[model samples]
Target: MTLPPELSPEHWITHVFSAKAARQGGVIRRNLRDIERYVGRSAFEDELKRRGYHAVENAGQLIIFCNQEPIRLIL
Candidate 1:
């Protein structure tokens, strides 16, 4: 996933969960704009929602709070 142009590369991308999987230490990853064009987290979140996933964003990371289990996501 790409990052928002407004946020610099130095920023840290962390997944934020609401009621579920709140203690998974919050998955952290690099927003490598080089690998992919900087797409906003909002856009990704919307896409996930469009596919029937419950998600939200905290800072730069988009966290999909799946009901059954946390999918140790790779960024």
Candidate 2:
């Protein structure tokens, strides 16, 4: 799957969980701000929805979770 050239790391979305950052049960979000600022909230939400992922905005950042099983988070 090829992505648009503008969607490189610098302007990419993230969905990796860090065990070390986990507390109780959830992982810490270190890149939320970067993702929100880089991708822009509206575009990010649209992409997630188009890709079949559920999106929520919390703390002014986008949170995406796969709606289908066998979670696959793509951008």
Global lDDT of each model?
A: 0.42, 0.49
Mark the regions of model 1 whose C-alpha exceeds 4 Å error after superposition: 1-43, 67-75
lDDT of 2 by residue, 1-75 (tens): 344646654335543322333323332343466655556556665665665555455676544454433444566
Which regions of candidate 2 fall more than 4 Å away from where they truly are?
1-11, 14-32, 60-62, 69-75
Which residue pairs clash within candidate 2?
none
Predicted structure 1, TM vs. truth: 0.29
Task: Report RMSD for candidate 1.
Answer: 11.2
How large is the C-alpha RMSD of every model relative to the true structure? 11.2, 9.9
Error of 2 at 4 (Å): 18
lDDT score, residue 18, model 2?
Answer: 23
